[model samples]
Target: MKKIDVIVKYFYPLAAGIEINVRNVYKHMVSHGWDVTIHTSTDMPEAKNSLPVIDHLDGMNIHRYPWRWYGFVPRIDWAHTPAIALHNFNIFPHSWLLIIVLIRRTLGMSSPKVFLTPHGGFTPEWRTFSPLSRFIKKTYQEILGVHLINAAVDGLRSVSDWEAVESIKHGMRPDIIHIIHNGLEREVYTQIEKLANQVTTDQVRKLGRYLIQIGRIHPIKNQATGIKALKHLPQDIQFVIIGPVTDPEYKKSLDLLISQLGLFDRVHFLGVISGVNKYYWLRHSVVNVHMALWESYCNVIHESMSQGCVCIVSRGTALEELIKDKINGFCVPEYDEVSVADAVKYILDSSHARQILAMRKRNTDFTRGHSWQNISLQVEKMYTTALGS
Candidate 1:
């Protein structure tokens, strides 16, 4: 099999789920005897001084491109503006290197089967979020980004069917859309589970029953709604919001809402816990709640479920496909505070029922078809098909 050159915008140090996915895919494909090289932006200062070059990491080659620095942007103000500005100003510049690399490869200067996974870039929610910015993005997508990506790649990979559909809506060629769910490494999942079980014995004694919500602290995630749902819950139960404080203003607003609802003590903001702590919290919590308005596919939901933590996700999108109501987990109407509260309360009150459902639905085998090894095999097939091999 020939080597595959994968191009992505930026990765690492951010600890975003998409970054993790990119890293895992690169690692797994190399392990499977496929020559895989990733092109990404470099964090190195000296590399930033250079333009249109390649930087090597371990045995994996990462091509670096100069990105324009937008210095000292206030987080609060930026959050209100279109998310695309964040992407355009920082991430999109790296993508322009794709054209340079493609031209070089066409001129017989480089050789590899090329593949592109834009991560969540092709989604409608991201495109539709800002009007003027959306127009700019749409123009870029149609003329430069989409066409270049289609022409440059041997295959297109999506994290979910939702992503594929969204890409098609934006006019991507249908035959090229390949669905591959992001996966949890088996070893990592095992380590987390073992650590979680040990911590459950210690933490369950102190925390009692609680709900866990994990993601970036942002308006789209609807943390305020979770806080509101706590107001409707009995005093004995609590809600724990975990993950990085990505938006300070949104965090402040959530704090104010919690205070107004008088849930200061009841709702806890455990900012960005990971490693053993993340697993421990997931293991001890009675259920996981994801109230985000949009998701291509959530790693948290799959990870929690793999750990036997029942989830309450919002209806619509790929979430509906993952969760079946009252079975493995529950799906309440999106943004319905009452429904969310009622669902949480029912799960808390009926521990035995929740446990039974969880046990039945619990997936201990993280290496099931969703593993990156398996997904990469499927990606390899797509590459072969695209090459007409």
Candidate 2:
């Protein structure tokens, strides 16, 4: 059977956006009878029981290798298989993987056709995020990264137009780039609807009339804006934040801000929710909010929209493409207390119940067709094109 291998920084037990997206894509691939194997770093201690561990998730194969001090080394045994390698993200671990693949090809050893997905890793903010990241990527791209991409990769997968533009700026050929929007599993809506039926009056009271924000708790997510907006919203309109704190310092800052604003009671953090409960919040929320510094594309925004919840998302990101200011959802013009507060208030006070219902219906109708199955089919076409080339 033909096989495709995925190379990413982390997988399973880690709920980063990219990991989830990859998992869903592979799952859909497996369902279509493609044998898919994921090659990723073993970042979670729980998944590190054995070296080069193999597991099955969503009917796809996952092979996790432990990370080394310098970087990752793809297993020598898998080299002979001559698989199609999909490299997710272009930094840290994947740089080493790409280099290793290049050297093997140079040595006339078996090598896989590579497909690169930068996942917005090359954004302008990347340079300011860390000095090492800037130096490593800049130095490598000039010397090796761009060269390897040009020589080894069959194509690039871009989640948004912004990412496609960035990839071109970084020296990838425009012809080989494919832009496919990210999508959620269709079952998410089913699970959420089921959970909505089970939601009782007591649960609603406990959850409160809150504006929910779901995503990894990192500095880039700008969760503080949501917390501050509580002061401007009605006292009963609380703020509920969901997702794991990927950055401890950012989490600490959010906690400090919550305390300073005397919103300890109004602001609730329910960390790392999934499945039915995750959708329950979105289905029942007054509105969902995401004020990220930027996004290649936000899966959570679609998740919220699919669950029929109107969203207040940050402007000037890929999210803007999903929302048309007050048409289907609200957009925060700026990530400030005033901007967020005003957006929330507009949704609350201005949008009539009937208009809000119409907006929700529009969102649900749009995202209902964006299933993983359809997305994977588009990817399968790309795979065929890659092989034909």
Candidate 3:
């Protein structure tokens, strides 16, 4: 059997949930007797200075490339820069570099099957800011060196149905797009149980329960609505926001709102807690509140439920597909702070009902079906089929 080569444009130290997916899938594929190599780039300072080469991580081969640094100087207001110009002048260079590396590796390999999992970066949401940005992305998709690299791939792997739909919109053959839900590491579930014990003991000392929200503090997540809804809740119940403050302006705005609403004490911003601390927060919280305007699939929801934490999510995008209202979790209308508050209050007041529901949902074993082991099996089948054809 030929080896499988997977090209992912973004990988590690980025710490997005997608990173977990990529890492686990790579490991799983290698364990299944598929020779897997992941070509990627790293922005970590230590990685930046080293020679760009392949290294063994877990069971897979990881090839890292040096990304061009535009300047040593950093700007305070980077988002203010025109996105289209940045896409054309900066991001495309990395995309092309990835293409060149893919071509070189593919030529030297023994007719290995190639796969590209863009990991949400190639979506319209990321590139469709302006007409020019859309035009440039479409042009690159159609005729650029990126397209040339894409053409060599046997199949395109998408993490969600939304991504598969987008791939078709971008002219990828529907039959060639495979929808695979990203998987959580088995360690996350184990850590959640350990965290529950710690948080439950600590909860005895603290006043009332907390509603937790986790993810990057960015405008795209619409966490401000979650902060706003905190005012509507009873004084006893607090809101805890845990995740990296990726956008300073957004964090500032959230801080201002917390002050204006007199929720300074009621709302806690726990910046970027990970590992055991992350699991502790999730396991301890009364309810996991995720009100993102758009998300392919919120891994936190799955992680929270794995720990038997009840979740309330916004009703839009693929969230509706992942969360069945009143079954696995509660779903609220978009931007309706009152609905969010109502759901939280119901979960708080009816703790027994909520726990029963959450436990039933958690016990359903949704994560088992979506495990990286199973996903890798599917991908291996695709690779074999691609090779045979």
Best by lDDT: 2
Candidate 3: pairs in clash: none
Cα lDDT tens digits, model 2, 124-209, are: 45523688767877787777777777777777788888888877887888888899888876667575554544544346568668
How many clashing residue pairs appear in each of the predictions shown? 0, 0, 0
Native-referenced Cα lDDT, model 3: 0.64
The digit string of per-residue lDDT tens for model 1 on 7-74 reads: 44455444556666767666765676655555455543223433345555435666554444522212
lDDT of 3 by residue, 1-389 (tens): 44544444345555566666767766876776766565555444224534345577777766666554422111112222111001111244435444544665557733334455666656635522568877766676666534544555556667678767866776666766777666665556454544545554564338467888888787767788888888888778888887766678778998888888888888887666666567667766778889887776667776776666777888856776667787777888768999999878777676568565655466346665555677767756666666673
* Candidate 3 runs further than 4 Å off: 1-6, 33-37, 44-56, 59-63, 69-112, 126-135, 138-150, 188-207, 275-277, 351-364
In candidate 1, stretches whose alpha carbon ends up further than 4 angstroms from where it belongs are 1-7, 33-66, 69-91, 101-112, 126-128, 187-201, 275-277, 351-369, 380-389
Choose 1 or 2, whichever is better by lDDT: 2
TM of each candidate vs. truth: 0.77, 0.90, 0.76
- Candidates 1 and 2: which is better by TM-score? 2
lDDT agreement with native, every candidate:
0.65, 0.76, 0.64
Candidate 1 global TM-score: 0.77
lDDT, residue 244, model 1: 70
